[model samples]
Target chain A: QQQVRQSSQSLTVWEGETAILNCSYENSAFDYFPWYQQFPGEGPALLIAIRSVSDKKEDGRFTIFFNKREKNLSLHIKDSQPGDSATYFCAASGNNAGAKLTFGGGTRLTVRP
Target chain B: NSKVIQTPRYLVKGQGQKAKMRCIPEKGHPVVFWYQQNKNNEFKFLINFQNQEVLQQIDMTEKRFSAECPSNSPCSLEIQSSEAGDSALYLCASSPSGYEQYFGPGTRLTVL
Candidate 1:
């Protein structure tokens, strides 16, 4: 069973538009959520992260809206640019799980200029 | 621009051959993690260590795979015998506080 899930396999959006990627998880023990961006032939880079105590986190044009009660979250990329095209992964971890992360399948995003 | 460094961007090994990869964590980071990413982009955690002590590892790692993080040398992961199923990208990450991790470019291993 996949502990973490992303709603879309791929998503496309125009430049200047907002692209939202959704994610959900099964294990309630997960308390820390992080989003990673990966380019071709490169490892994933941490984009943004949120603790279960908060409902939202924003960094530059990227924002994460989290609903702890629902076990779901969304990443919103505002003013999407072609340079932002990449694969995004949602990962979760908890104190019980140590520092190991459980990652979702990932969502490939494309921004058309 | 990750400080973590992984050697041999790509490797090709015949079946049953030993495959080894190395990772150097970021400066001052004590926690290190290894993960395997397949062609399908599925990530499987292999093992993790804090300083020179191992914290956790999967069953596959406990068997065919061996990893060690020495006090001053770069961390290494070695497969006892390579298999077709072992083909994947190996990623190494380091964490300052164990909550957030930064990843390296990764080493792609192809087994025939």
Candidate 2:
């Protein structure tokens, strides 16, 4: 079974708009959630992360709103830029899950100028 | 730039041939993980290790898929007998505590 899931297959937004990507997970044990960004021909890079203890985190234009009760999370990129176009993957892990990660099917984000 | 490094960005092999890939984790990290990503963007967890000890792995043909992480040497994943189903991108990542892993550019494998 797919433990982690991404609700959107693709999302499009214009520059300067807020782009939101939603993700949900089935394993309740999941405590550590991370968002990775991948540009074509490159490996995925850590864009943002959130622990279960916190409900929200922000780094400049990027923010992660986490809902532990709902087992869902959302990544919000404010002031989106054309350069920000890439595929985003949501991943989950926990103490019981070990070092291995369960990843969600990625969301391809496109930003129009 | 990613601190992790993977060798041979692409590999093409005939069915039943041998295929190998290497990864060098970031300095000071003690944990490494391997994942297989198919064309449809599905990620399959392959194996993971802490230092020289393996922590977890999936059930595959033992004689076909083998992986190891040795001290002072780069980690390696080898397929003794390749199959068309093995055609995918292999990604390597490393972390200090396994909470967050840094990924390297994947090695695309094609089995004909």
Candidate 3:
């Protein structure tokens, strides 16, 4: 069974618009949720992360709105730019999760000019 | 600056040949993990280490793959006998705790 799932395989948005990518996890043990951004051949960089204690985390143009009770979360990219177009992955881990991350299939985002 | 470093951006090998990939985790990160991303399988967890100790590994890792974190050196994951099915991007990540892991660029392995 797929533990964590991201709904959209791809998304397109105009520059300066808001793009929302959704994610959900089946394991209630998940306590740490993070979003990573990857350009073509580069490594994935941590865009934002949130612990279960809080329902929201925002940094710059990226924001993560988490609903612990529902086991769902969404990444909101505000003022979406061409530079933000890439593969975004949602990952989850819990205490004693062994440091191995469970990742989603990923969402490919495109920002049109 | 990239904290986690993976060498050999690409590697191609013939079936039955062994392939090896290495990883250098960020400084002070005690845990390391290996993951595989395939077109057909998506992203899958393989195994992990904590200061040279094997913390957890999947059945696939136990069968044909071997991984180790030698003292004071970078960690490595090696395939004993390569198969076409083994072709995929191998990624390495590290974390201070078991929560947030930072991933490397990933080594793309192509088996003929």
Predicted model with the maximum DockQ: 1
Q: Rank the candidates by DockQ, best first.
A: 1, 2, 3
TM-score between model 3 and native = 0.96
Task: State the iRMSD of every prediction, in order shown.
Answer: 1.8, 1.9, 2.2
The TM-score values for the models, in the order shown, are 0.98, 0.97, 0.96
Candidate 2 structure quality by residue, lDDT tens digits, A7-105? 999999999999999999999888899999998878899988999999999999999999999999999999999999999999999864345788999
Off by over 4 Å in 2: A96-98, B61-63
lDDT string, candidate 1, A1-113, tens digits: 99999999999999999999999999998999999999999999999999999999999999999999899999999999999999999999996434799999999999999
Docking class of 1: medium
Report clash pairs, candidate 2. none
When just chain B is superposed on the true chain B, each candidate scores a TM-score of 0.98, 0.96, 0.95
Candidate numbers, best TM-score first, in rank order: 1, 2, 3
On lDDT, the stronger of 1 and 2 is 1
